[model samples]
Target: MRLPLLLAAVGTAAIASIAPLSANPEVELAAEDMLAPYYAKLERELDLPVAPAGAGLAEDTVLTRIGVGSCNHQSRSQHMWAKIAAADPQLFLFIGDNNYGDNGWEGDAALGSLRAAYAKQAETPELATFRKAVPMMAAWDDHDYGFNDAGASFTPRRWSETLFETFWGSTEEVRSRPGIYDSRIVGEEGRRTQIILLDTRFFRSDLEAMPYSETRPPLGPYVPSTDPDKTMLGEQQWKWLEAELAKPANFRIVASSIQVLTDAHDYEAWENLPLERAKLYRLLAGREESGLVLLSGDRHAGGIYTDTPDETGGEQLWELTSSSLNLAFNNTASNTAREPDPKRLTDFISEENFGLVDIDWAGRTFTMTLRGNQGEERVSRTVSW
Candidate 1:
């Protein structure tokens, strides 16, 4: 088998340096036994012809609208799908933590279970209704990557990648390529929008465990240093991202699973990968023509951030992060007072909320609304370019 560039790097000295815990042999076997039948079903499903897209939705359509969220489990949050589908957006971007794959990887079997979980969620009436209207795209986080807060050091990283590919239904061309950062262009003339999705977790370095301290809350907050060589998108993906951003688009949206602006929620984020975060921001700042905006999910809440240049002279871009189709066990706090930038670093923050973004192709103005479960608008802001 020809190893892709990403697999080649991962199989070599890089991953070898960080020895990972071996999975339990029995769990692997059990997961495989459960997976066999699902794979067969998926093969049949993929064989079905995809529906044709709307005519007006051509590559050069004037405006493009997108819906985004993260940290969803199938058994919970079944109600949110209908409301989300009603929005009738152009695309749905899942920002990761899509599944809770705590079970050890037992080859295709483990993958089968993961795929089955996603299927149940996707088949929900609300999501199914929306799928008929729009296509979906996604990137993986730690949960879906087979471990919580893992990196290149994860034992099943390769297996996890394959499962992600199977679930997302990307073309073989995409699957065969290395690294998951992807770009999409929409609209025509002055209304063009470019969306760049970053793959943050697949090849990440292990986050240093926070040290315990008395003065500080239990664990002292850890922040990433701007090490020139440290990275978030990995080498190839970073190169691809830079080239993608350099293109001429009316607006550019960068989607990340973790907060890029806020320093709070110190477990994992761009803050933990400081050099990579700065490199990304500098890229946006340098691209004067591309009207850049950021999108994120993970915190299980929704909020927005506007880059406010400080007196110390730093550029700040905007970030809009919405999270959780339903709250997870540990992250449920995110649904209650879990602001992405609690320390007041971000311009706006909210908990127990979702978001909707609207774009007016002719007017060149967009509205972003933070909403409650009942679909009542809590916070609304407009962005015009």
Candidate 2:
């Protein structure tokens, strides 16, 4: 199987250098003899400072600027943090692929890799300063969740959840759940904004791979799974989402680790489970009273998509996706898996990028922008509610 370039780069070096406590005699003996002190040092360095309490933004505070991005390789330079900080967002949302742990090995090796990745991220001066300056929330995609394109079947999911909670300091209510899906209401009363972080990886069923055909052009290896029984969020999360939508919030931002609006992309996305996508649309349609916007990551390239009013109950539903804070698919020629989305408002940007959402309460308008590492705006769309 072809590995992601980042995974390939880390490859054996990670195994040799960061193997955790293992039962395999060779690994175990090596850990005890040579890696123990290294692990100890990493543990000390990984100690992230505690963020001030509360649900990030104050309920009474006006919601304005927000920063979002994903697919950051832990070992790589996170030069975007400075630009992201410069954007002056009140909150930062890390949608997924937060770290390229790619811990497929069994037992303690997975734990060790996760620790090492988190340690690298925590040690980054820019990242540490950003964390101190901005209140942040996160959701994990495949890499940080312990495997590539992993889902409910990933055996180490619970262990991954444990690590994620500890490193991110997730709330007790979120930690109590089998999955990391959580929702928080920020802002207050008439200006309240609900941020629903979806756990797409935990309950998602296995995706269907496309069949090879001699007559058809190979779009990619995946096709929509027509299985009505399959789900992206499990039944419990679905119920919780319904309840969240019913809450009286002026606007709601649903954070998915993968693109929800771009169905033509033949990658890991909501398109793989058409029924679930339909369900999400239906949910939004049913709750037109609550203004809804989608946020996502995972795709290295970033763009903004808007569904027609007909599809969203006379209101255009917008999805802003930002990805690869430190990594980008510069070779666009080789990445032709995505079909052009009619709803796309901006050119897809394949560079080290992040997204900014600026809400104007006085004008009752919002502008979303995809910006490069240096804070240069690549594309932006301003729309009124």
Candidate 3:
């Protein structure tokens, strides 16, 4: 069921700072009363937006467009979502790290933080408007999952997993599944398009820490080992993905919070799990899927990366990654496309913008545009693949 448009609720922690009880008891009490009911209701109705199986497009497919992005600091620019809504996308994919909730803790404090963090975003006027208009789905990153650069072994992992499912509005059936990863279909013109939403953070291995002596950036330009065991998509999800992809579909959109293709982002990405990245690339290359596109968010910028087939009969896949709908860090370095790095597999790159993906099945073409808050088109491209 669709929820009513909600006013931005203050994060419990932020509320303490914004409206300390000692300073304003009356206002604080009123806010608490209003927020308590909604919070309680959501906890109970965690499994609300479950679309039935076999539920998808039939003949006469509709033009579907999706807007994707990540690393949004909801507290910074929560009211600026209109720029995204103006594009009129039917779906919004929140890749991960949606809320900067610390993952180091669990229990009442951690869950409360996650709820408050999401509450801050949920109450934003920009997101609220879009939610009222379009459907939204999300996955988790380190922050929302409990720790910065954490993995499946984290203590809060299971609880964080349940919270992610509930907050994103999954169905009871889906919640019963072993993992949060699932697929949905939207069909048109006798062609069915499957959107595969994968859960990367749910079962990731811990990212190695950097050496303190290194004077370089805290994140990296470091190379990851190509060990066959080092993985981004864990074993279960990886196996599930193959089966899901093998199913007949006209198109597939894989959503991940981390960068799928290696890039110059000094942040975390699939590159950190090099072997897994190669495995995914090889899988897509060998797969016979008609139209395969990758959707990712997390870099705080939007970019389109396509692979042209080589002499081998292997197929090529295209990736479109957008980040930070409201908050973007200005890349001091040139933001233009750079030559593909030989060391790392990153093909193209752009930083500091959000993305709008328009799919016109009837026209047999897809268009994606990356825009800044001022509505400037930072990057725009279309592909017939």
Candidate 4:
């Protein structure tokens, strides 16, 4: 029998902040009333993971075009893949929640379900075709990482890491690291582009939820962590990130599985770990000459955001957040389905979509675009440092 997503997500303290009230009958009843169609859609998902498409992306490659997306439930339609493929990006970043492997299950069994989840995604014809055509990089978020909003306390994380390597390939530097964080410097010196994908779950501390009254959707369950002892990337990853930021590159795309610049939202983001968020800003601020662009996923919605923190001066720190390649919950009708973000520079997308970035190496400018299901640029921005 298929399990419900919310039930297993809150099965442990590791994910308590995501939905601590899952045991409440009223909450369950409300869920059923509001999202029955979403549940029905998940029930139809089958276990059918395809074989690995073989590793791609050479170290020497100079990528000017890249695609990004996350929060794809394998059981749903991947209609956006075709559009993303049509855009002809050289590399694609499948940032997080690549599949709902542990969505309705928990414990060791939840981690075990990842095998089939990876299989289901691989067998998807549209996704298969896209991967075969486009060289890709990936990272994991809550659901695909074994539980929703889970972190270091999760026991099955080590096992999940092994499975991730098996399907995504353990050839890169990530294979040697404890967490999934990775970096690549492509192109020659003058045109170097650095791609860094971070692992947000492995060593992250448990999140503290706000009072139950403020824990509802649209309100968000988490508040900025006041405990300075709490960590998001841990000490080792922090050292690694600092080293990566210092590397020579004309442009850098820092990929986080969660949002880094949005402090207004109470969801799972860097803002939830205030100290760590500030640390990241300082690291990037120390090196303002390197063109910086942030890529993030995990939110069901997608949008463009920018911030000019005091650490980084007046220059804008651009962040493009794209998500839910399939399972879109952004509804204009439901006030509870969405919330406001002061840093957002464009309208958020709740439907199937992907983000594409274009860099003009000679001109020293880049364009960030959110492409819709029909291959149209729904939102776009171009700027130079």
CA lDDT, every prediction? 0.62, 0.76, 0.61, 0.77
What would the TM-score be for candidate 1 when compared with the true structure?
Answer: 0.76
Q: TM-score of every model?
A: 0.76, 0.82, 0.75, 0.83
| Pairs in steric clash, model 4 | 48-119, 48-120, 49-119, 49-120, 50-119
What is the alpha-carbon lDDT for the whole of candidate 3?
0.61
Model 2, C-alpha of 38: deviation from truth (Å): 23
lDDT of 1 by residue, 264-304 (tens): 66667888877677677777766638566678877665666
Better of 1 and 3 by TM-score: 1
Q: Which ten residues in a row have the lowest lDDT in candidate 1?
A: 47-56
Residues 285-308, model 4: lDDT tens digits = 876357779999887778889988
- TM accuracy, model 4: 0.83
Predicted structure 2: lDDT: 0.76
lDDT by residue (tens digit), candidate 2, 275-333: 88878887878763766678999889888898754445565788998988988866333
Off by over 4 Å in 1: 1-57, 103-116, 212-222, 226-228, 309-315, 328-352, 361-363
What is the lDDT for 140 in model 1? Answer: 76
Indicate which candidate wins on TM-score.
4
